[model samples]
Target: MSQTNNRDGSNKRSRILSSDVYRQRENQSSTNVAQTQSGLIIDNETALSSEIIKEQLNSVDDIITQAIIEVPTKHLLYVKELGDNLFVSLSTKII
Candidate 1:
């Protein structure tokens, strides 16, 4: 690998290792993917009807379900959940 030295005698890597965070570090650019989004929260009273979630639950069932509805990306996707409780919204714009 070649190294370039600056006028002040500092050096940097010729090629940077690209990952989720450092991929755009060259332009000092920032990305929104690393940021966590605040999603909608609802309860029993506010729960809407859906064929995707076809099950009855009590208060503590902590049900989490989703369907592959059409997104702007033209591909289908669903929510990613930590368990039966927490859910992460999935969308193409999240990038």
Candidate 2:
């Protein structure tokens, strides 16, 4: 199994109150990044000027749009599985 480390470099595991939601958000964020990066080239290609391209790239709406495009529909299932595993681990600790 894969393990993640805390900021302190300790092997301790931490649980969040709403990890399912958090994971979903994280997946979405990553998807958005991928989308934005892929779209940057196309967006830049159509710009009349370098300044315009830079301005569009910097806009919050454009960023969000790219994210919306890149977000995969399949990530929902993966996030759910992660949440279930986390719940099981937490329950095991409690017992």
Candidate 3:
């Protein structure tokens, strides 16, 4: 999905539909398959770019990305924790 630049240059966040995100994922999957067939390696840096993450999580209102202090190239993507119990559950599921 191509995003249009605002003429006013304001930092306005637009709401992305879940369907759009799903379509984008499908397109990427096909491209990745082609790349893999051609012997290309998808590295961490390419796979985890901020723009890609933002596009993937566009429908999520509270998506966040925080760089690992020791590893600038690595980041943790998550939503804000609403509560301790919720965090525990999410972490458990993720792990």
Candidate 4:
């Protein structure tokens, strides 16, 4: 099966294949094969850029220092509690 969409002012087609068909076709075409093998097609450059963004977001020491430097001491408690809850929720996964 295939689906078409317009992205960035250009038309693109996404092809979907079942697992057995995918394995049979894997070595025949390299253009989109790796992506299908991994279950989804994501541009490599976009993935690398987002990884950099994620590293910055998870920098806890910088976040804490900035909060203490800019926010009132009384508000620090609220920030801490929110951070703790956010951490717990992010680390837990639904099955």
Candidate 5:
């Protein structure tokens, strides 16, 4: 790959967080949420706690995952198995 493409690829790779890495950083307060790529740290007061969600979907692999996005809150809840094409399209658009 060209130098620019290689740099871009590295940037993308750096943004990815393993579940272990995420769990490590997930303890910080929501108000202290960093403005950089880390991992999703959903507020405990949200409708679904991350722990509960994980337990409910136990054993599934990457069906619903979280990642840091390039935004203020930095977190993105990525649902990989949304079966409805139109819903996915609209959701992506809204996002």
Candidate 6:
């Protein structure tokens, strides 16, 4: 906000360190994705492969079903029967 004079008697405006506006400059080559020889850019090679993605998703259902089946019976506080299916409520109490 103030001006300071240099030893040469030239007036120079001093920076007041304004934080109202911030800027970030990133270098392009520092990114996580690497450019292939064919000019194709890949980030985590297995992440984009369909076979790997399908394999990862395929196990999700089994993992979720296993987690549900492994829950302790004591945690089931409420149960409602609907035809051949069951709607169960699990307790979230810390104790």
Cα lDDT of model 5 by residue, 10-87, tens digit: 877766646457656554535544433555444445377788888978966666577554654323323233333446
Q: For residues 11-69, could you state the per-residue lDDT of candidate 2 as single tens digits?
A: 22234435655677556664324233335422223326788778878887744653344
User: lDDT tens string, model 4, 1-95?
Assistant: 13333452243222323555676676555643256655776443424467788988888785576333564577887887787887676667868
All candidates in order of lDDT, best leading:
4, 5, 2, 3, 6, 1
Q: C-alpha displacement of 84 in model 3, angstroms? A: 23
List TM-scores for all candidates, in order. Answer: 0.14, 0.21, 0.17, 0.19, 0.24, 0.23
How would you encode candidate 6's per-residue C-alpha lDDT over 1-94 as one tens digit per residue?
Answer: 1333353233222232222111111234436666654777777443467887888988876557533445535445333233224424345443
Candidate number of the best lDDT: 4
RMSD (Cα, Å) for all candidates, in order, is 22.3, 28.4, 22.8, 17.7, 23.1, 14.2
Candidate 4 Cα misplacement greater than 4 A, ranges: 1-72, 90-95
Q: Which numbered prediction scores highest in TM-score against the true structure?
A: 5
Q: For residues 10-32, what per-residue lDDT tens digits would candidate 3 score against the true structure? A: 33322345556656765677544
- Backbone clash tally (model 2): 1
Error of 3 at 42 (Å): 12
The runs of at least 3 residues in candidate 6 whose Cα sits more than 4 Å from the true structure, single-residue gaps closed, are: 1-47, 66-95
**C-alpha lDDT of residue 49 in model 2:** 75
Clash count in backbone of candidate 5: 0
Task: Please report, in order, the local distance difference test score of every candidate based on alpha carbons.
Answer: 0.38, 0.53, 0.51, 0.59, 0.57, 0.46
